[model samples]
Target: MIQPDYIFECSWEVCNKVGGIYTVLSTKARTLQQQFPDHILFIGPDLGHAGQAAEFDEDTTLYADWRRTTAAAGLPVRIGRWRVPGAPLVMLVDYRQLFSHKNELFYEMWESFGVDSSQAYGDYDESCIFAAATGRVIESFYRFHHLESQRVVAHFDEWMLGFGLLHLRKYTPRIATLFTTHATTIGRSIAGNNKPLYGYMSGYNGDGMAAELHVEAKHSVEKKAAHFADCFTTVSEITAVECRQLLDKAPDVVTPNGFEPDFVPTPDRYPARRADARQRLLRAASALYGQTFDSDDTFLVSISGRYEYRNKGIDVFIDAMNRLRTSADLPRAVVAFVLIPAWVYAPRADLKATLEHGAPTTAPLPTPFLTHWLHRMDDDRVSNFILHAGFNTTDGERLKIVFVPCYLDGRDGIFDTPYYDLLIGMDATLYPSYYEPWGYTPLESVAFGIPTVTTDLAGFGRWAQTVVSGRDITEGVAVVHRTDDNYAAVVNESAGALLSLMRCSDAERSTIAAHCQSLAARAEWERFITYYYTAFNHALTAAARRADA
Candidate 1:
């Protein structure tokens, strides 16, 4: 392993916690921290997202001299430690000042690397400015620290930070650069815009599709960075294919995302948390539909992530629930929760009042399925789909669909629990994604000892097939075969997976859950981090060769 003396990792999700990249970096920080100590640093935007930085324990005095020096140089940064399990050093850069030079930076990017910024719109300019500012911070830090002789690796993540990789390549040629694209811009755009991505993936010209999807500026920068970086990497084998087809640059390495096992509660503490979570979830469901449910008899299942109706398979999940509702063979009552965030106005006051009353409810609340009220209730895809499926009135339904349309960060008022706390209580989890790159939610579900159902189209599902040597939901994960046109079949298979799980005896369920957890053990960072080390070595060796030349 060619480890660096200093490693600088940059991402738009360092402390912001918007998406899966946040999970990837935060979970892997401790292992890296153990090797590098304070030499490893993470750089992120200082957007001051209210209480989002709770995990960031700022220590201005730790890097006082460098902070003053960078301040003098007009690059404001707050030095801190990410209060995750690893507590690695973190630097949140204030990139607002760089917005003034956005045009000049874009012009230079176009001139030096052919990153087309002409068609940039919306948050593109903001993200580009942040990326440029990240480059500036690293350049300043490297010089101030006077580490020209030391081997350094700078890893930039996703398309959001692609411009920063270019900035590093042009300005800091000695620094080994690795760029990892979790998903290609044009590929996700094609899937989101209702195009057949998998079927037409081979024939689609990335540049042509970028123009067709109006993602030229983003696609150009990502492609250029992939070409310029010392090493180009992605998170999964499936996404590597997308990079080859859509980004037009096959990755040098595939660093599948890994999780820290420490995040899971200890076996001693598990029972209480699991019971409390189940009670809270059951109580909330009871209050929503005004129906009392037996905690032991109720089977809790959920699908949680960013709300993508087709892409994340909300439509298919609802369809399966529709099938489960009418299936007479189900032995127990199942409560399905859609724990995805939407444009919510606030938590429902009536539900809060009902829960606080601590009384069993037999009268349903108005718009009972949703835990939170959305600003665009009429336009919300999940709610509209469930409504169309006749789930608006689920009082009589055995398979109850409850929509918790808010971030479950232990503060959603109803659950008052983080995602993993509730996730551990689930009997089964479903993430039938149609356009998933790595499928972290399903992976996470299995890690928590919950049998999960996912589609082969997902990278995690494909990986699970290799690990278990076959497709069996009973082996802790059910990898359903999905394609661009197998919508109905996928739905039927997903519903069948749930039905089979419900039919399992207690002994069978225990065996299956244990198997799922064992599979998750195979995906731990201890096993998966080697790929990253290989990628790091690739970048460093290439950079060394270039320096010698």
Candidate 2:
């Protein structure tokens, strides 16, 4: 292994209880340290989130002069650090002032541009002051580690730290810069502040919200980051195609993201582990919602993701549930529809209300994004519609739809919740990520020893088809192809496949789940993290050659 001496990173959600970026950063911390003998300094702006930083130990006092130096330089370092498993060095770039003021700056930019997010997407440009200061702050931290003459490399993930690369690129210790766009900023930009259910779209433009600010021309941040860094990447292969076409830069390599397989037990060791996971799910469901449910009596089909009603095929799922429930000669199966949607803060008033009212629609749910949040909405009326919708609760036939709107701490929620147990017990995982750069949830659900149904648009689905012994068009976890001329036929066929698995013998289900888990392990982080090290090495080798020239 060509271990580098340093690795620097930035994340807005590093300390904040935000998105998948936290999981990505925390997991990589220890692994990067193991590879780098000297230091793998992680510099994320803390805001108030620094207090909740995991792996936190007792605080050490920093000299006022050094703190003042950071503040004077505008980086405002409030240091609290943690060394995760397998990491060599630990450094927290806690900047309470800068982080806390992000909202203020977001609005200031909006006001200064004379436009509001209500009309167009809101984007806070941090390529200037913040990047400049953070670059200096990181430089100081890096110098301390490289005093022993360490080969240095740095990474800036997403637009949040786009400036970090710009600031760090010129420094002598800056061996290589790798920029990754987890998702296109321009893609998220048009969505403005819309809820996931209401996916926002704008005509393709690189300038993005900058157009509202009246910049003469437009450009992609992906392209900008590519130009700034020595190498660039997206989350998956399909996403790479989109990036190349849209951003005008092809990623050098596809560093696919993966879940830690062992995080959730896969029942390969103990045959009864599946039953135990199911029992746990039942108990948690009863405890959390005051409703008794049996794992056998309940057939669980879940939709977990950012709730893009169309893109995620949330519409298709609900419709299929309705169709499946009402089919003739079909046993009145006790089916539970579980949606642990991301962006729960977005208003789901009408969507949740319709479920409450038992009013079904063939078309998508009639709700727009940017609606304020409404939670704790389970009333007797909603519960009644869900229970009495069509099947028999009296003799083992009913459809149960549960919308869990809280944060799923990997350890507590699905990760550790009866959720995985329930997954192991479920009929199938439904993932119709219409625009998935790559889908992790379905891949993960399978790793929990449950089969999944994903669409072909995802990078995972494409790869799994190559390596995984997939379910036939009749019974295995399938990737639904939407572009087929017969869309209805394809969907109906997938529904039949799902229904068969739901009614399969216990032994058959276990066999499929085991196969799925084995497929995922082949692509787990053990193989994927090597990509990060390799990508950095590629960039540095190229950089060295350039210097010699």
TM-score of each: 0.98, 0.74
lDDT of each: 0.88, 0.56
Which prediction has the highest TM-score against the true structure?
1
The sequence of per-residue lDDT tens digits that candidate 1 reaches over residues 314-372 is 88999999888888787788899999989989889999998999988888888888899
* lDDT at residue 98 of model 1 (Cα atoms): 78
Clashing residue pair totals per candidate (backbone < 3 A): 0, 10
Positional deviation of residue 170's Cα in model 2 after best superposition, in angstroms: 4.6
Clashing pairs in 1: none
Q: How many collisions between residues are there in candidate 1? A: 0
